[model samples]
Target: MKMNICMVGALLLLGVAASGCANNRDLIAKSVIPARNDVFTEGGNGAQAGRAVVDFTLLVKSNLYYLMGTYGKHTAPPYRAHLNIDGQTTILEADPILEDNNSVGLKAPESGTGWKYQFSKRLTLAPGKHRLSIALPIDDVIVEREIEIRPGINTVAVTPVYKRKMLRPYKGENFSAGVKTVEIAVN
Candidate 1:
């Protein structure tokens, strides 16, 4: 009789514990983009810019890290990557790309578009990996996906784009639209 009572108590406690885990995934209150968070799609939540930027921002709860993306013509004279990590801002330029920081990326890496480049930056995360957030202050464009980190070694990519000037005479007069693709993933 006593054994039966104890077994029932254990099962009850197990049920509650399982439910707690499910709730945690929903804790991130917000994400980087206003639309659904899908990196594989174009013009969804995040927008990849050219040398001419349409800036944006993103917001999150706590703990978790987020990434932004950019791509463009790499072999040209104007290429820049500007990032803001927790308020501390850093800008990467091409002169340093070849001089000190081996920060190398393929020029126009994407197929068909000889003007898209992709790259990332990883962040050192804290314990209790909270909600993931990536802000795009450039035109309110945020690029990120959901993730759960255990403790150490957490990373994110911050991609800002610089584009060659649109020499096309009709660019300003008409609607000019182009797509530059960059990707972020983990094992």
Candidate 2:
């Protein structure tokens, strides 16, 4: 009798898990179709109206590592990015521009290891609320925000920040725990 009850309970749990997965699949299917359609359709006739300019900048570290005894200067890798606003998607690619001493939150070691690359874009958008999505495929970073674009110039900055544990001084185990999150700030 106990064996039978255990089997029945297992079957019931399996059924519930299957049903939950089905419901999630249905929800994703329904939502994806509309988003796909929105990408193709024109936004509206608001092109002649007042517009706002968005200056977007993304700062990320290159995959290349500069060692203490490195001989020559190495160039950063190229990156591909996607900027989507209210269903309008623009694909961007750029060779990484090398920069130095642009660290945030904490100061770097005396070896002068604070180096990064910058990618920038200027977008003209209609004055209204917008859904902004930024994706860096190579870096596996995606950030989404609901932003209000007023008439004038606005700035959006995307940066990769280090994890809290990684910021601590000279911890052996946490040394490899790099970026914690990608932060997006608008002003």
Q: Count of backbone clashes for each model?
A: 22, 0
| TM-scores for the candidates | 0.27, 0.55
- Candidate 2 overall Cα lDDT vs. reference? 0.55
Question: Which segments of model 1 are wrong by more than 4 Å?
Answer: 1-109, 135-140, 144-146, 155-186
lDDT values, one for every candidate: 0.32, 0.55
Q: Please identify model 2 stretches exceeding 4 Å from their true place.
A: 1-49, 65-77, 97-115, 163-178
How high is the lDDT of residue 162 in model 2? 45
lDDT tens string, model 1, 1-187?
9999999999999999877544423322233113322212211222223111112221111111122533233333343343432223333332212111123333321112122223343433333323334432322333444544444343444333322225743322111122122233332
**Candidate 2 lDDT by residue in tens digits, 55-88:** 7787665433546744222334345556777766
